[model samples]
Target: MATTTFSKLVVFAALVFVGQAALITKPEGPTIRTRHGDVRGMYAEEGAIFLGLPFGNPPVGELRWKPPRAYNKSWAPEVRDGTVPGPACRQPGCGPNKIDYRHTCNRDKNRTQSEDCLYLNVFVPRSVLLNSSLRLPVICWFHGGHYMYGTGSAMVYDGRILANKTNTVVVTTNYRLGVFGYLVTGEGEDDARGNYGTLDQIETLKWVQQNIADFGGAKDKVTVFGQSAGSDSISVLLTTDKTTDLFHQAIMLSVPFSITHKTQLEAIRVGNDVAKSVNCSAGDMKCLRSKPADDLIVAQNEAGKYIANPFKPLELFMQWGPTVDGDILPRQTVDSFANGKIQKKPFIIGNVREEAVLYIYEAFSKPMSKLELDGIMLAFLHGKGPVALHEYNPPKASDYRPFLSHFATDWVFQCPTRNVIRNAVVNGENDVWLYVFDHVVSIKSIWHHKAYCQDHVCHGEDIPFVFQTPLLLNLSFTREEQVIADTMAYHYGNFAHTGDPNKASPNVYTTGNVLKSPLDWPRYNKRNLFPNMNFTTPQSVIVKDYNKEKCDFWDKENIYSARNKGK
Candidate 1:
């Protein structure tokens, strides 16, 4: 009887052990199942990070100069490693002496460059991912390098800090640059149309729309934001009918609006120059496509050096970009916005205080004389030179770089931005806000080798503050600088969340990163005094009619009048 009782006790103990084992679940890593494959990411203090996820097929071989195709290869049974960043797209390497204030060229030194560079990175806060019901707003970023250089994987652009602070998902993507992306020969079976890079951007947006739900993101709440060349790309994308449903809001930072896109004839000329450099016929697309990417980069650089825009001489500086393709890009950005051809959405557009100082310092090694300034004005405006010179006359005639910088600022960035904003408002688009980043960068070495921008609020200066990268780099910001950085992030975060810069996110308190600014950002309108937020240290304030007279003059003269003549 005792042996039988012991046997029964052993059977009961075994059953209890089995039941307890079934109740305890095993801990899993930060693994996400995407449509392309199952990817294993790493967990940082703030969130789960997925790096180097390919959204499109490799654009190599016969796929060169073609629109991007969706990534279809699946790694279903096995998990793909996404811990390392992908290679940057093929571009010309810049030396240490070049104007790499953003340190993009140097960042490429650490990563490889290849034609298969259609990859993107994602950052999701830990709390959002763990909670099944939390779906955060998404901010898709595009980096700036004049459409010539830059990768989405640069260290300075890491989206972890921004994701953590804003409690949103942040995605940064890579697009082709220079000849590989924008060269147009008017040949080939596909016609070799330009704007392949912009197509890549659209492909990325499609990927986000399809896959972001798995990463705790709201597909309908996506906001596209960029700086400089990236911002210009957004302006072009705004006009395209293809991106109508991809994004709900936009924030263009320091768009170079005066640098008009190339016409079809001009693009063909540039393409011919490239082909000629490589010992091929102007119309022979097969030969151009078969050549090595490195060889093509050299040819594109050579072509850019000689192809000057007669209508706007300054446009030669940015010769290779979006072409006015009749279908995808209906017309120029300014014209499209003015005619209400763009998708109706809320947006924030702004420029820095000294947007042109960086370019001026790079162009001229020494200060300019009054004679040289007059010559520059004539070169810029042609028949209208004298009038422009009189209108933009400097108070201190001897030291004219400051005024020259201001004139270039108004012409290239500030004035044209205002014109677009006003046009958008008048055309029944009521939700638009304007701002000017008026604070100078406090960190001297962050300027890379170009120390000239240390004292001025130059182009690309607002980026670090927006990303709050100083904290990521173990560098410290001054008390005032920290406040400004927080304030910019706060406004941008709010804009991403609710499509209103002044409305704080309801979930902001959950992240314990609540941000506050004393000033209330006002929507831009003709009746509201055209208030523009001046972002600076200590506090940000609103100013009315910023550069009104200069903007009005440029709008009247219409530097891009050639676009209308052709239309």
Candidate 2:
């Protein structure tokens, strides 16, 4: 209670776990000795990239559907080659919202996918080798896929630019997905309990605490970050007391606060449906386990038909993800933040201006009429349809499904997250920075997505700029795009370095006057009406309550809390 708002409950977990590391001579020639084993990484212009480092043992055979086991470091090989990315956990190859890392943009389909995919990648700045006393901050990224697809190994998630530009270690980790990750037998702790992915993330963070120091990262300065499902996972981690020792700060980007964590019974029912789909009895644990991974994957996809009711008014979220088990996540995520049960730590939580454009663009066969838009608002809010329609009014209908996406975006993503941020700052005395990403990148043209953007910025448009991946990957970016990218990297680097994004501490980028209004990012406390930074190119300005009226309307109707109980 006596500590400042920036941090509290600082960890000694790294000290206790890393006692033996100071005893061993650090590895030579771009290699580092982890508590588990020695890993040799490849050098890059930005930093040293250590790829496919298994943080957990393969979740294969008997280990499937169980809590992740620490990577068996006692292997015969003392030195592990970490240049190649580990196989992505077994997943359905292609879908509307999915990106097959192997065949993205219709590239080669040669990359492998497997159940034995519990690995992570680390990117450390090359400069770290010069100073043995220097300990840099770390940003551990969790890739988003509705908690059902994608991997850390994906090309867009390459951590090189972020590490090099930010002067901090960047880690991207892979966790189980879909039925493989979230299945529960309702058999309690002994059998298949859901949250394997969340547990894997916790284990992977533990691994980071033990080994990151060898790669020039400070274990105590680890900040876990993610977008979408990954952000949702961080939202869960904030609620769980067990993960307190693994992280110091947080950066959540566009959390779908409306998404519900599955109840134990709901998860068990879904698992039962999976078992039945695979021709195994509800209680046939062995049969389910023995089934081929691909068969299980198919069954998993098939099981979704039952969980999400298309005939129903709306299906706003994924059916499989973090479950509220008694162990890992004991309570609803939003409820935890609302009740002030979350750890009081600095946080940066923000959403995009158009978070739901892609959803509307992809799912709809034709553009919605104004009448249809009103119907959706009604369905999403149940009997409060007229009120929502009145609040989210659009005068003359545009070519696009004008108001539908806006309504869905605020209802599902923006407002609820804002609630958590304000709650943390106002109630728990935590420093919370808010932002709205309004930048539109040209990389969208290169992507194979069905969506188009003349003025719209889709969900995750902020990422390429954050990492400067387009420049690194040889994808073309306009001169302005590069500048915006630098601006983003500077802010993110500053945040990773010091808990505050506005203050550049250990990580400094001299962008003097290049960015308009490149100054203080005000905290969303009780004061100042919670003004937010609008992250667009050229200049980033502060806006008061960014989407105040819409968010307030939802708050008045209790839309945010209602979704937690709905699905």
Candidate 3:
């Protein structure tokens, strides 16, 4: 059900869309002549907002499971309406009985869902829009939902505050999700070889390159940034030359690097499970496409139960994702980074402190027993479990949930992130910086249902601060929280303007209230004990080799799927 305020917002959007039907030579609000048409957007206190702009044609019917086609049709004579966001791409609800606030089902309630969802939203600051001659750096955001659920235009990712504070044109886009986006059959030409979502991202970058200049954004100064699955997509973008000309720099938040991308056969195994659930034969593209979207969603849920990634059991939680299709993604992400096959673009990559707490709680209803912990270690770490359990050193008799949570955090997010950084730097990829988001958000309502995340700096905790959307949610930020948000936006804004996060470009504007980092971040290197920026309260400072011993153990174990498995 939609809230009264949201219902009113929708009514207002409809009137605005209908009212601006005809083309006016000089409209009142901020107008931009895009390649598709002349789009008229609304003006707010912060800046101009252009929502629901199509970057690619609707991926429906024959287009399902195919690469996105650029939205080439023109709405010139009839002005294209950019008032409200386009419908979120088709996706499933949250975990079975669990109330995960992050899922698209909960976040995008009462909002339309459709296959015609390849739309992107643009947010430009009032100052930047007022000066027709000024072209600021652009930041393109990719929302994350484990590549299964999430939309770019959700209130949580409202780019207005970030755009105003960063002084950059912010773009949030929607791509296909679930089986519709990443179901793979086989290596045949007719097969839906996965990574359609990745292709959609590529098409988005191409569109930005062609049309961002009209919205006061420099195409050459584009920076791609995202969290979780979005970050995973950006990491893939960094490896392939397909995105070489699309973006200049990248910012990856909470990338699940340890959940190794599925091999072609592995993807096909899951695809077949989804197909069988719907009574369709494997590799039957026509049959799969003919089925209703609802059927596919249900099938996707059922498929997770039938298959598992033996090398990485955690993958069963996030089953539908990009596949190593040999074409789009030639090799695994870490392998590419380790072998120097990746583009040497400037990037900042990091993760939250207690990334796996929520996930751990969700996986276990109550505190885990020592036996369960031993089983987890054996299942996740293989022969390396005994050595790892010795290193982690959990209490034998008491509940081991905390130990499991910390271990999962280190094994899944923190250690893998450090591994990627180490690989990138060792392979001569410079201009890289690292950080750890250690502050827990003050707003408890965001995770009200998930009580375990109340005090932990869990996954997705940094999003509200990064976009500064607490005010939009009818909530307020504490003084310390506000400072942290300001500091993050400050560094991110500087990074978008200049390759270095500490330095701001002359072209970009900075306000008197903009917060600065307590210390200058140093380039990540093998020497100097690998310093990383610890983004925390009153002041964010540089820390040396966070969880160094734990990461060393994981690295030495050589258990990560892609490690020591040569390309």
The model with the greatest TM-score is 3
Q: Which ten contiguous residues of candidate 3 have the minimum total lDDT? A: 1-10
**Scored by CA lDDT, what does every candidate get?**
0.81, 0.74, 0.82
Candidate 1 residue spans exceeding 4 A from truth: 1-29, 94-109, 395-399, 509-515, 560-567
- Residues 1-567 of candidate 2 have per-residue lDDT tens digits of 111111111111122234543454433326666666667776554556888888898999989988899876654356778777888887786543455322221111455678898989988774564454568999999988878888887777888878877888899989999988988876744568889999999998998888788777899999899998899899899889889899988889989887667677777777888888889888577888899998998888887766543323233357789888766887778788878888777888898888888777766658677777666655565667676677766776644465677777888888987887877775765568898888776665544545454467778777776766666555777767766677777777888888888787645543344442356788886577778888776667788887887777776776566343333
TM-score of each model, in listed order:
0.91, 0.88, 0.92
Per-model C-alpha RMSD: 8.0, 8.0, 6.2
Off by over 4 Å in 2: 1-29, 75-78, 94-109, 308-316, 394-400, 510-517, 563-567
Put down candidate 1 lDDT per residue, 41-61, tens digits, no spaces: 765556668888999999998
Query: Which has the better TM-score: candidate 1, or candidate 2?
Result: 1
Q: lDDT tens digits, residues 356-399, model 3?
A: 99888898988777888888878777777888888878766567
Which candidate has the highest lDDT of all?
A: 3
Clash total of candidate 2: 0
Using TM-score as the measure, name the better of candidate 1 and candidate 3: 3
